[model samples]
Target: MKLVTLAIICVLMLNSCKNKSQEEPQNQVKVEKIEYASFGKEIVASDAIAAKSMASHYKTMKTGDSIDSKMVAKVNNVCQAKGCWMRLDLDDGNEVMVKFKDYGFFVPKDITGKEVIINGKAFVKEVSVDEQRHYAEDAGKSAEEIAKIIEPKRTYSFEADGVLVVQ
Candidate 1:
């Protein structure tokens, strides 16, 4: 009788341990894989506004005024020289010039026409003629086209802390 009782207790303990082990994985949180190529800082592709909405927000902003935002847009152009900057289409005729924060990161130069999510500060600024010409040069524009950027232009700009190029 004593041997049977000991055997029964051991089996019960083993069963309980097995049950606990089986329940652990079910209680664990699931982690989702990121599908974007990240740059600068790691950022998830969540809560980003559409390009059209982002354009509207830019329209309401003035020079020197900025707002923290996350937006998704199509890459219209990128700096051909070294991928230092990019232009994103706002679903409108206007494009927003995006530069990485602190010049810390650069997106792939061949990523034009790809969708990207950017997290940063959006602001309106008057870009000087010299700067415009410089950018035109970096874009590999013709000499005449660079010369045409003779006027200071007010434009939408973003300083991105993080960027994710959709793969």
Candidate 2:
């Protein structure tokens, strides 16, 4: 009976240690809001929060960089359909399409002329011609308009979670 009790006590002690070791650090990292650049402006992420959380934050991309989760520049273009989205231009000369999250909020179409900050993932992809046409249709474009929709050769797409609209 004594040996069984000792064995159980050892197991419990080991389990407790294991659990404690698996716990995360007490000091957690907080995401800070940041602003990006414009079409011609050379704005960049000048904050520490962006530096620590995202490795590629504010770094210019040549290719294969998707604008999904990164602080990126705002592209210069207005969503002509419903004035819902403000596009962002990435450092790689790739246009990162920016829109409010969950359709919860929207910026003025004229805001496209300003600088903004976005935190999200960046995806470099070639959207199929069909998908492009579909988007064009959704934007209330005519068949000729849909045909004019430029198929994405390679786009650095940014899907922002939280955005800080900066002038």
Top model by lDDT, which number? 1
Model 1 quality (TM-score) = 0.79
Task: Candidate 2: count the clashes.
Answer: 20
- Candidate 2 lowest-lDDT run of ten: 48-57
Candidate 2 residues 88-151, lDDT tens each? 6554444555555566555555565565666655555567788667556645578888877665
Whole-structure CA lDDT of model 1 = 0.94
What lDDT does each candidate get? Answer: 0.94, 0.56
| TM-score, per-candidate, Cα-based | 0.79, 0.49
Q: Model 1: which ten-residue window has the lowest total lDDT? A: 32-41
lDDT (tens digit, per residue) of candidate 1 on 1-167: 99999999999999999999999999999997858999998888899999999999989888999999999999999999889999999998999999999999999999999999999999999999999999999998999898777689999999999999988
